[model samples]
Target: MKRILLLCALVPFTFMTSAQNSRPNIIYILADDLGYGDVSALNKNSQIPTLHMDQLAREGMVFTDAHSSSAVCSPTRYGILTGRYNWRTRLQSGVLWSYDPPLIPESRTTVASLLKQSGYHTACIGKWHLGLGWQQGENGKVDFNKPILGGPTAIGFDYFYGITASLDIPPYFYIKNDRITATVIDSIKGATGKGFWRAGPIGNDFKHEEVLPQLTQKATDYIKEQAAGKQPFFLYYALPSPHTPILPAKEYSGRTHTNAYGDFVLMTDDMVGKVLQAVKEAGIENNTIIIFTSDNGCSPSADFKELKAAGHYPSYIFRGEKADIYEGGHHIPFIVKWPGKVKAGTTTATTICLTDFMATAAALTHRALKDNEGEDSYDLLPLLLQKGVYQRTYTIHHSIDGNFSIRNKNWKLEFAYGSGGWSAPREKAARTQQLPPVQLFDLAKDIAEKNNIAGKNQEIVKQLTHQMEIIINDGRSTPGAKQSNDVPVNYLKYR
Candidate 1:
């Protein structure tokens, strides 16, 4: 009621009130493998500094208990764009590779496509690990000569620029539309060594060292191009930063407690600054919904050993880091700056997931969402706008191995016996300390998830289990009365 009343009061006072369909420009800035501790605004224990990102949080709203859809990359990206859980897809386990099939099916409605249908220009300008099927060559290599198939363009972005997968993956060339920004002339080893990336396909101008600069330039250029047009644009600015092989610009190297990882994160902050500047320079800062977040928690390999040796909690108070089913793997920093709409210097404890983006976009644009559209995504505009405590009802967590952990009304249940993805690779026997086959934590009481309370509360456990079953079987969570929007899409239909 408070939120609704607040919106009612705010709507007339602010120019941001929706017209029949005067949609706002949207910019989603995603950080690769960043943790809750990566940003100073979220964690003050002291690591790398993020000026631009911190500013973003200050100007908008910072969701302290925010989470990524999954603990790893490909799956989380699947959930982010589709607003549905990735596990629902055939990718029941691991992530996608550089040359894999499209993560999103043709029928599924992505934020880009949904907004595009509403007359908003959309573009994805960063890492696209969701996979773009590549054509093979005459000599039996990835025929870099072939146009990338089933990519962002096919997914609804009027303009697309990004990598088919992770930067560490071979065939490290950038893609503009369906063609490689750098052509393949030499054979480069694939990420897992399965395929050789035909190099030289990229221009002599392209180099791994120039990736951040390259993507930044392209994004700024795209913004500039969009500025001239009157179209309300949505830019999915997923940055390729703070991820492995930590390569920061020459000036950003050697600037943090951890190592190259922190350095690269700092560089990513500068990239955010550039984007924010573009929004301001375009004079659309207030109307643009600029959100900064991470795909998932920081990777354990990202200087974790060094940080542990130094007694620094990279994942902060969270038990596991990255791939673990623990909070650290999925808990991430989320900041939204909607100028006139969202309140400044405010924070929310709402347990929201990245999957809610689809619904949020649809709601703000006055479009409806079918129950199956992004079944997992509940509209969070109310929360972001600081209208009131619009509870998420529940948020589900998926581990790298398909293990599931669910959080609803403060009680979280993990279906796995132990730390699902954080196995101590070196010590097989040392893994016994993990939770039993099923562990439960009252996050409202034990935010650290240090104790398992499943045995203590049988009724609660059964109820949550029943709820989880319903969510899985029905293909949508049973919580709030779902709002009618775009017709639901069965992702499995075209798969």
Candidate 2:
């Protein structure tokens, strides 16, 4: 009887250990300002080849209706890392500046933190626009030489090497871990080009054109180093390419017929290929889970008119570009490649948000999340594995201008009267024309959002409006206690 009891007790423990050890290494490759149509695998009419991106999609599962939590950079990143909407934070609209205090509170749980707690090594390489606590000097001047506080390391990442903000933003320099790689004692004037960066303090050896290649090499090196170790690793390789300062390397210049932007995109694709190759060469390709996605839709800074003339539509069939409440703004390409786990060459129209990363990671590790954590995140592993049906109850969309839109099932309701961004029929113009107070679209019927059926769908409008209010008031969409928003979130006044 004693011998039989011992065997029974050890069985569950052994199985649990095996499951924990079986957790694969995760590499999340996030492209900056990449559009749904940019990847050839996702868009049939793409002008750029994107061979590597296509291959990844072919070998993995493609999420056709995936979207970023927000239509801009920092906010989307916040959502990805925290598994909570950025609007819940103090930053209600726009992005954080390079010199601003850390947007992610030290107390908040991040995806990296969750993975780290699950015995995985975590690193964040590339653009970190979520903000850093730079030490302030006299007259509120930034002390670049000092070790910056409240950065990636302070939150969760064990290693962090990247830029503070977008390539166009000022104080251009590179940061390794917590300190700037080089001292910024000189000012670099702005240069003229299709992709221009703002003039600001620049490090002596920091070159804008070389940032992408350097980051790619760093990421690959990290992967190789980690592969030799026993512990699994999580690498958040945030690419700062194909965004602004479209400086493609000489070898990649003019590689595409579209324009310089296209050439930059080609370079970006090549970078992805390099990382994928690194995983293969490291012999961890099958044991690694590679997820390729974008921060948001393509930026208008890509010179849409010229690209359109060249027969390239960055937003694809979508109506608007970045920062719009429309599909084109937050809708992004999400491809996951987990060899022997996720079925190959499969596609799912199941709508998902970037904020879902937290809960998915939790589910993968078999860890239970607390009520305060992952308030808006839904576990996507079920959908990815095709084990069961997984769908979001509703997905909230936020724009650069603080516009709010809610989507439930096939119906989408935009509380704003216009695009709420840079596109035509802006807020002022719409008001001048006496457009309706709100807009509703049957996304199933009009994917382009050309026709507004708000008047005809008053019932849906009321239901969606009430649902949105409930979600906002409850402070979460997932099942939990009613939490509190970090700030007052009034959707009516565009706050």
Note the clash tally of each candidate.
Answer: 19, 0
Give the range where candidate 1 is weakest over 10 consecutive residues by summed lDDT. 189-198
The C-alpha lDDT values of all candidates are 0.77, 0.91
Best by lDDT: 2
User: Positional deviation of 279 in candidate 1, in angstroms?
Assistant: 1.1
The lDDT, on a scale of 0 to 1, for candidate 2 is 0.91
TM-score of each: 0.87, 0.95
- Every candidate's CA RMSD: 7.1, 3.2
lDDT of 2 by residue, 351-390 (tens): 8999999999999888998999999999998888989757
Candidate 1 lDDT over 447-495, as tens digits, reads 8888888999989889887877767766676354543323442222211
The alpha-carbon deviation from the true structure for residue 191 of candidate 2, after best TM-score superposition, in angstroms, is 2.5
